[model samples]
Target: MKTKSLLLAALFAALTAIGGFIKIPIPYVPFTLQIAAVYLAGCLLGPKLGMLSQLVYVLVGLAGAPVFAEGGGPSYVLQPTFGYLIGFAAGAYVNGWLMQIFQFRKAATVFLANLSALFAVYLFGCSWLYIAMKWIVEKPLTIGQTLWFGFLLPVPGDLLLCAVCSILVARMLPRIHSVIRKQEVVS
Candidate 1:
């Protein structure tokens, strides 16, 4: 990877951490702008770098940085919300991969890509929530309850954020691509 790409990845990792700090506390999942940052990182950086950015954020948190919505550490894996953190990296990779394949120029395509990415996030997040609650935390919630808490409740806000991100990406992506091209040439 280019130095510029590495720098951008680090920048997005910081942004994701910042997003975790700015959150509205709720029952199980706190609503945060981390998802938006993740999406933007994917849209701007493409697949490998986008995934690298989120992985950096996750690793930093695991290394005992308080960069997560709750606190952070190795033990954070036991938390119900930890799955969502993993989902961030997965979602970014999916979004970046889709964008690369589709060459998302239209707003609709961008929005679709965002939605697909969102699905990946929910898949990991909801699954983790279910497993953590049932086995790790020993709460044993029903699937319906897990879906309600993990998916349904936070999804509306997440959808709105994704929509906004899609619009932003649609407008800004061309410029970002050109800048990246220039960076590659200079490198």
Candidate 2:
């Protein structure tokens, strides 16, 4: 990878970690700006690097950096919310992949890509929450309860953030690409 790409990936990883600390505390899952950061990473960095950034964030948290929402360590994997951390990588990849397919020039396309990526995040997170609650944590929540806590509760805030991110990305992409092009030429 180019030096710029690596730096940007690292920057995003740091942003994600920072985002974990900025959250509105709630019962099961606190709302965080992490999703917004994830969306921006994918929209700006493209699929592979975006995914790499999120992966680095997760790995760093797992290595006990205290970078996660509720602290960090290998033991965090046992936490019900850890699945959302995993989803960050997957969602970034999916977001960038879709943007590549539909092109990121239009607001609608960017919004659509982000919304789809949101689904991926929720799918992984909700599924993991259900599994962790039922078995690992031995909480044994019903499906309805799991869905309510894991999906329904947090989604409205996420959706609003997604809309804002999509607009930001759409507006910024052209300038970002031009800069990248200039950098490549300079190299």
Candidate 3:
């Protein structure tokens, strides 16, 4: 189980990194493929495994891998964007948790799950940004500004990714479950 978990985590991290390459830059930040990856990771992997996948991505990037947005290093991980990276873990974890706990196989259920995950991501990312700005930049940001830059700007793209990924994952669940089951059998 540990080996399989690690392997899947590595795979998701790699996928997240690759997805990060597809960027749509906004004023405050860029929209990336990570949302889709996060949604898919969570819906398919379940809460624990999905969160593990995101954690792996973060650890890999922090370890000096150039897999982060706009290239990566230790410095980038400390930047404001790092908050969003961390949020991805929350997004995936909550997304998977919702999917498993609720019947999210249908369209409406998927929508809510994705929305919940997005909300989780936004809350975490914005909170971290607010504190980081206060600590590092020495400028306190307003709720409006944070919402504009951190939450509002990213929502459209993230939602689009969520919709697409949710639909796709709904279909792919059987195959994913099969693989996980087979792994359990083999192990």
Candidate 4:
């Protein structure tokens, strides 16, 4: 069970790196499936493993793996978008926690879990963006501007992704859980 969990976590981390490469560029931030991969990791692997997966992703990128959307290095931490990268782990953790709490059984619960995960990501991303812009970039932004640039602009797309993630989680969790259970029995 431990080995399986670690293997799956590594796989999800790799998938996240791959997801970053497929992006739609815009001014504020690039739209990528990376968050979706994070969502799937949590919903599929549960909180601990999912979070572990994201951590691996971050660690690798920070170590200069070039796995992130732009590029990767220790200095990447100074970038405004680094907040979203960190948020991915937090969001996955939240997603996994909600999935476990709701037992990943109901459509509404699945939707709520994904939505909450998205909120977690947004919260972290926005807060970090605000701080980084002020301290790192030396360009302070008002709360209204932060919301407009960091939160509001991306919301509709994020919400749509959350909805799609919810549906996918609903459809996949049962089978995935069943396999995990069977594997646990074998172990």
Q: Clashing pairs in model 2?
A: none
The Cα local distance difference test for each model comes to: 0.91, 0.90, 0.82, 0.86
RMSD of 4: 1.7
TM-score of each: 0.95, 0.96, 0.88, 0.92
Those runs of model 2 whose alpha carbons end farther than 4 Å from true positions after fitting are: 185-187
lDDT tens per residue, model 4, 92-183: 99999988886876667787888887888888888988999999999988888888888887777778877888887888877877987999
* Every model: Cα RMSD to truth: 1.5, 1.1, 2.4, 1.7
Name the best candidate (by lDDT): 1
> How many residue pairs clash in all the candidates, one count each?
0, 0, 0, 0
Clash list (residue pairs), candidate 1: none
| lDDT (C-alpha) at residue 71 in model 1 | 91
Measured with C-alpha atoms, the lDDT of residue 3 in candidate 1 is 94
Candidate 1 has a TM-score of 0.95
Stretches off by above 4 angstroms in model 4 are: 181-187
lDDT of 3 by residue, 1-187 (tens): 6886788888888899998899888855688888787887888788889888998888888888888887777777546667888888998899899999885787667777878888888888888777777777667678788888888888888888777877787778777778879999999
